[model samples]
Target: DVKVTQSSRYLVKRTGEKVFLECVQDMDHENMFWYRQDPGLGLRLIYFSYDVKMKEKGDIPEGYSVSREKKERFSLILESASTNQTSMYLCASSWDRGGQYFGPGTRLTVT
Candidate 1:
């Protein structure tokens, strides 16, 4: 079975703090992605890595960065937390052009 796991299910931080969200997949996929889900905007990809040390910025990568050092792990970093950055973050992994499986999601809140 393919499984994706995030380090946190929920996180609360004050404004201006730096936050790190971790994700690990069991599938050994080459592509990993970070997305933020908002009510109307739906899921917006923040960043993605197709290979180790190779990353591609998605539509909303302004306030976010990603790391993929190993085949099974990927990390997301929020440089500066803010109220507007609060959203449900999802991590997904896929085998070369295969179906993507997503983690439960991390609900982040910034005050």
Candidate 2:
């Protein structure tokens, strides 16, 4: 089965601190995504990369950035973490149109 693994299951950060979240998929899928899930808000796309070294920002990418230098790994960086950025972050990947497969999640708390 395909799987996605995130660096941390939960994180605690302070305002204005820099943060990094990492994700890796073993399925060798070409498409990967990062999103934040909030209560009643569902998944809001932050960024997605279709291929290695190529990426595109999604609906909400203001406070976040991503890197995808290799095919199996993608990293997300928060230049300056904020309370509003404290949300459940998800990593997902898929092949072609099979639909996104998700990681368990990373719950970030910022104060």
Candidate 3:
């Protein structure tokens, strides 16, 4: 069974703070994705990595960045946290066109 783990379940940060959210997948998936979910906008991909040391920006990548140093770990970085950046952040991993397994999201609150 594939298992996904996130560094934090809930996070609270002030504006302008740098935040790091980490995700890990047990299966050696080749694809990892970072997405943010809001009320009306639905799931918006922030960034994704196809392989180690390779990343691509997704639909919304203005204030976010990603790193994939290992096949099983992917990190999401928020350069400068803002109030509007507060949302439910999700991490998913997949391989060979199989469905992705998502981690328990991180609810971030920026005030």
Candidate 4:
């Protein structure tokens, strides 16, 4: 089974604090992505890693960064949490053109 797991299901934080969201996939996927799903706006990409130690910026990577030092793990770092950044964060993993499998998203609230 293809499994993508998020480290946190829900998170609450104060403004300006650094936050880290972690994800892991059981399958050996080449593509791992971080995205946030907001009401009306749909899912927007934050970052993605196609190979270990390699990363790429997506649509909304201003407040975020990603790391893929290991094959099965990926991490999302939020430099300064803000109220505007409050949303559900989803982690996904896939192979070449493989359909994405989602984690049980982390709902982050920046108060």
> Model 3: per-residue lDDT, tens digit, 1-111?
899999999999999999999999998899999999999999999999999999999999999988899999999999999999999999999985869899999999999
Candidate 1 runs further than 4 Å off: none
User: Residue 91 lDDT in model 4?
Assistant: 97
Per-residue alpha-carbon lDDT of candidate 1 for residues 1-111, written as tens digits (9 for 90 to 100): 999999999999999999999999998788999999999999999999999989999999998888888989899999899899999999999978768999999999999
Higher-lDDT candidate among 1 and 4? 4
Which one is best on lDDT? 3
lDDT per residue (tens digit) for residues 1-111 in model 2: 898999999999999999999999999999999999999999999999999989999999998999999999988999999999989999999888868899989999999
- Candidate 4's residue-wise lDDT over 26-47, tens digit each? 9999899999999999999999
Candidate 3 TM-score, true structure as reference: 0.97
Worst 10 residues of 4 by lDDT: 92-101
Residue 98 lDDT (model 1): 60
> Local distance difference test, per candidate?
0.93, 0.94, 0.95, 0.94
Which stretches in model 2 have alpha-carbon errors above 4 Å? none
- Report clash pairs, candidate 4: none
Residue 20 shift from truth in candidate 3, angstroms: 0.1
